[model samples]
Target: MPGYRKAVAILMFAVTAWYSEARAGDTPTYSISIVPQFDHRRIEAIWRPIIERLEPMTGFHFQLVMEPTIPAFEKALNAGAYDFAYMNPYHYVVAHRLQGYQPIVRDVENDLYGVVVVAKGTGHRSGPSSQRSGQDL
Candidate 1:
């Protein structure tokens, strides 16, 4: 099988196990994907616990895809390869413009917007700055 098929198979196994275990209750089928970020191993390690908790708590099958490159991820998202995704600002905006992606939920504690700042002298960077203070960031 191809890599995506393998991934889907693995995810399906996890979901199936979760579903069987949670046979007492109704469950929604979840399809989730994370955007490409700089830290792959670290994030994946951290997220395992989150997934473990989610499967039991939600009693739903989850399908998660983690990619390591933005260009490739964008291509995949454009192809509608995922049911849900966590993407960055530019990609989020672009995806909305191109493919109609919108945020359904966010972690209020840490889901702050992006910030762009340039040196006092040059002032040649692109985009505007965040109005919020650094303490929140």
Candidate 2:
């Protein structure tokens, strides 16, 4: 399946499981936060449709939280402001450390990798840092 569809399906299953575990007679509204890689308008436009459909299917209300910047989002995420979150691996590591957040899914098809660039004659190679120098790129 396509990455987005697979992601949504996995999220739906997770949300459903959480919803079923809530205490009796308690109707909780969950918050979903996405990393602020895009502006609020674009983020909402992309996520709102998915959340709207999820609400009815899961029998739970969801609030989409959009932060204005990456730092702002990270601050909120670290503070445990969100019930659910979509974040980069670095943020995920911090979030898991600080808030004990458990990962429900990962996009194996679209893995994230870092690239390093340096001057041509700086005794640096383009691949791993070990090939270039002892210092990390």
Candidate 3:
């Protein structure tokens, strides 16, 4: 299976098991926070299905919390505002360091890369051409 699909499956099962064993009188609502890479509406649209699936399996209410920005999301994460979180690698590292958050699973097949694109007719240069002697940008 694709890495993302596999990760989601693992997440579903893990969450279901974890919540099923919770204390009887505990709140049934769980909050899941996702990094704000897009607008809140779009983020909700993408993640709502997953949360809905978990609700039936675990018999718990799931709330999707989308922050306005990455920093805000990180702040909330550190404050333990979320019971679960789906974050980028950098955010994951910082959250783990700051809040002792443990990673449950990851999309191993997804490799992140950085690319720089310029206009076709522009004379922009990179590497040796873009750098001055003894200086880098």
Candidate 4:
């Protein structure tokens, strides 16, 4: 009777060990997409190094999946295509409501003030950027 009890215990232990080991080999995954706030080629270049560095350190393998444009990114995100992403504040809010993405951190360089100048009156508009007051262009 004691031998039967011991055999069952060993079997349970082996199954438990195997189950835990199975998932250990899998890499954690994360993704970054276009944020509603700043959708520019420059920002993508700036963020590249940071994402590369974070991949190995955090043990989270990351990939940048680019679509046709900013609006495409939003569509993909709404479709639940990524495990995680870096997005703008307004995007974070919308995604949080729509896709259950929460803010883990925000960029230190997130805030910036923009200006447009007419070059003191050339009668021609110079230094006039396309962005309106609220959106980044």
Best by TM-score: 2
Over the full model, what C-alpha lDDT does candidate 1 score relative to the true structure? 0.50
lDDT of 2 by residue, 1-137 (tens): 35666666656654565455555556668788888887788778777877987887677788998988999988988888887778777887787678766555555455662111221222323222234332222
- After superposition, candidate 4 runs with Cα above 4 Å error: 1-24, 36-41, 112-137
Ranked candidates, highest lDDT first = 2, 3, 1, 4
Model 2: residues >4 Å from true position, as ranges?
A: 21-25, 113-137
Candidate 3 off by > 4 Å: 1-3, 22-27, 113-137
* Backbone clashes, candidate 1: 0
lDDT per residue (tens digit) for residues 15-51 in model 1: 3442454556576665566665657776566455556
Each prediction's number of clashing residue pairs: 0, 0, 0, 0
Each model's TM-score, in the order given?
0.54, 0.72, 0.69, 0.52
Q: Ten consecutive residues with minimal summed lDDT in candidate 4?
A: 113-122
- Residue 2 lDDT in candidate 1: 34
Instruction: Choose 1 or 2, whichever is better by lDDT.
Output: 2
lDDT for model 3 comes to 0.62
lDDT of 3 at 22: 57
Residue pairs clashing in model 1 are none
